[model samples]
Target: MNVLVTVTEGATVDDEFRIDGLAIDDGSLTTDLNEWDEYALETAVRLAEADLVDEVVTVTIGPEDCEGTIRQVLAKGADRAIRVWDDALERSEMLDVGAKTALLAAVVETEEPDLVLTGVQSADEGFMATGVSLAAAVDYGWAAVVNALEVDPDERIARVRRELEGGVEERTEVDLPAVLTIQTGINEPRYASLRGIRMAQRKELAVRSLADLGLEASAVESRLRLRELAEPESESEARVLEGSSEEAAAELATVLREQGVGR
Candidate 1:
């Protein structure tokens, strides 16, 4: 069995920052491997460590600037990495879920891994739909919000524990050649050690373009367009109620009454 883990570069904004039109100012943002993806990669590495899988590969759809993040994946435990990027992707303002699905679907076709793993959601966009969408695109079975996983290669089945709403947990089985969106807290992700980091430098990190994947630039053109970007409007104000407990309770009641929140 083989496993492919999908990862992405996630960005965090500075405490004080300004918007650069539709996006945040580049200088004020820091990028790294996504939080959720770390768990997904850890799951794949653990499978490899258990000798249940032959190879652990990671795929990403980002430009060359994200090579550092890809290196992190290698340093952790992926056998190799595939990075998909092109002029079309760099030119586009944004790649919607469908566009991303198409890109990933191409890689999935080329790799043909027995099991696909992805973070439940990207730290930046948080769409939380790519794993299922990719499964649909590749005609693979899929399960989402998976907190635990066990695979039987001979049986060709992936038993998964899904975290559902309201503290509910559902255990189910997905057929082989499937995609599973890994949820955080499934395991403790390890940091890249000094030796792992050195070894990663020698690992094969392949970069491919859409053309190499037999895809055209038109394949990445997104139908969705961003209309606007602005800060959310502040709708309420806060007041401090400082005094005896009884006095504070009375003030809270008065404030609630003023807002017509309670009778």
Candidate 2:
């Protein structure tokens, strides 16, 4: 199996608020690999190491600064990486998940990977729609919020297990050349070993521009517009109950009912 994992250069939640002017874009804010994306990368690495996959490639669409993130994934055992550079992407203008999917679909088609994987949702946008949109663009079967995957190389089938309501799991099989959006906590992401980091530096990294993909800056459509960004209204302080345990429970239930949180 050959797998492609797409990652994004995302701002931290705080950074998002800061950029929106709810706060300040302080240098203290930290940025790193997205948690859900790490699960996808780790899953690909494990499959490669177990001999179930021949290679794992990581791809990201961002500015030049995103090269650090690509290197981090390469150090974790991806065979190679691809960086799609677009300066306008830095302003977070492509906020529509579908628009981002279109860009990724254009890249994935060129790679010709057997499977494409992405985080179920980005921590920053939390749209949770890219996987399905990308799959639609390429006309592939997609499994969303996948927790596990088993690939049958001979049959070219991928059995995917997904989470359902009430802690249940649903399984479905899709032909190879599919897309999956992986949920967080699917697996433990491996840290880059010293040896692995050294090896990553020598790996082939293909840098492609949007024009190389024959995509114009105006070709992608944005279904969403950010009218304004602001912090969520501050939550009111909680009130403590001054009564017995049973009374406190009753009060809690009353509060829930009043808030329409309980049926």
Question: lDDT winner among the candidates?
Answer: 1
Per-residue lDDT tens digits for candidate 1, residues 77-169, read 999999999988988888998899999999999999999999999877799999999999999999999999999999999999999999999
Which regions of candidate 1 are displaced past 4 Å?
A: 240-263
What would the TM-scores of all predictions be?
Answer: 0.90, 0.85
CA lDDT, candidate 2, residue 67: 82
lDDT of 2 by residue, 1-263 (tens): 79999987666744343553533364635567888999999989888888989989988877777788888889999999988766555556554876677688888888888999999988777888888899989988889999988888899998999998899999999887899999988898889999988988999888877687778766566768766665668697879876999999999999999999858
| All models, RMSD in angstroms | 4.5, 5.5
Against the true structure, candidate 2 reaches a TM-score of: 0.85
CA lDDT, every prediction?
Answer: 0.93, 0.83
**Over the full model, what C-alpha lDDT does candidate 2 score relative to the true structure?**
0.83
Residue 188 shift from truth in candidate 2, angstroms? 1.3
**What residue pairs are clashing in model 1?**
none
